[model samples]
Target: NAGVTQTPKFHILKIGQSMTLQCTQDMNHNYMYWYRQDPGMGLKLIYYSVGAGITDKGEVPNGYNVSRSTTEDFPLRLELAAPSQTSVYFCASSYSGGGYGYTFGSGTRLTVV
Candidate 1:
């Protein structure tokens, strides 16, 4: 089974272009999160969802949007992509509010120039 899947493992975007990074988890976890890691930096939460139809903005939600319509899917949308948005995105999921540990996707590397 695919624990978690993220599409477009790598992408290059010209400034002002937009794209959606897709994430899906096979494990029926109640919590899902989007995190971005800058070069030589730790990951920062961009957004999260506790359940379907419930979403919350995390530490760095600016210039990005997210929607959780089902337990298995949470997609992140980049708006007016900018150089500042260049980073590697990771998607993770866990059950029981993360007490069971998380299953993370391979990650998507994005470059905005």
Candidate 2:
């Protein structure tokens, strides 16, 4: 089964263009999160959802948005994308917290210029 999947593995955005980073899971997990990784830094949570129809913003949600329409999907939307938003976007899910670790997708590398 596909634990997690992310579309458009690599993309380049114009100064103001926008795109949606797609994420899907087949494990039926209840906790899903969107995180962005930068060089030499740890992942920063952008948004999360406990379950379908319940979404929340995370530490770095300013330049992004997210929605959890179903248990197996959590998509991230970037509106009026900016250069500061350039980073590797990762989609993850877990049945529980850190004790169980997390299943993450390969990540979508985004570049804005």
Candidate 3:
């Protein structure tokens, strides 16, 4: 579907390396979020933005960064890759932060060695 697209479906990173997980949505949702899911664990929110140029940290924002430059793009950046950061990253968007449903990207599987 053209709802949300995440690039680089799989990646392997060395310690101290960095990468950006690209996320884009065609639905023009105003609320975007970056989340990571570890094995046997629930999804942890990393970052979120309500609109363009506005962002806030979520539950787990230690090793990640996010920017919402426009309504369609919200990229999550890993400054220094760590083994603990290895997880499946997901991007989701919603029309609003209330009870509205969200459209989620496939996911980006990252492994930091």
Candidate 4:
């Protein structure tokens, strides 16, 4: 089973263009997260969902949104995408909170002009 996967591994966006960063997991994880990593940088939390039907904003949630209606999928929506939003977005999941290292998808490198 694929642990987690992200589509369109790379993307280029013009200012104001929107895109959805796809993410999914097959490990039946209950905690899913969307994080962005700048070039040669650390991961910054964007949004997260603890379980189905539950979601919350994270450290960097501006211009982005997320939903977790099921246990497998957690897609990140980028609305009114901006140049500042250009970064490597990584979708991750963990079976336990703060105890286990998150399983991260390869990543989606987004460039906004």
Please state every model's RMSD to the true fold in angstroms: 0.9, 1.0, 0.9, 0.9
Superior by lDDT: candidate 3 or candidate 4:
3
TM-score of model number 1:
0.96
Which lDDT tens digits does candidate 1 get at residues 1-113? 98999998999999999999999999899999999998778989999999999999999999999999999999999999999999999999989665678789999999999
Candidate 2 stretches with Cα past 4 Å from truth are none
Q: Of the candidates shown, which would achieve the greatest TM-score relative to the real structure? A: 3
Positional deviation of 8 in candidate 3, in angstroms?
0.8
Taking all chains together, each candidate's TM-score versus the true structure is 0.96, 0.96, 0.97, 0.95
* Cα displacement (Å) at residue 103, model 3: 0.6
Estimate, for each residue in 1-113, the C-alpha lDDT of model 3 and write its tens digit.
Answer: 49999998999999999999999999979999999998788999999999999999999999888888899999999998999999999999999985899889999999999
lDDT minimum window of 10 residues, candidate 2:
93-102
User: lDDT per model, in order?
Assistant: 0.94, 0.92, 0.94, 0.92
Per-candidate clashes, comma-separated: 0, 0, 0, 0
Clashing pairs in 2: none
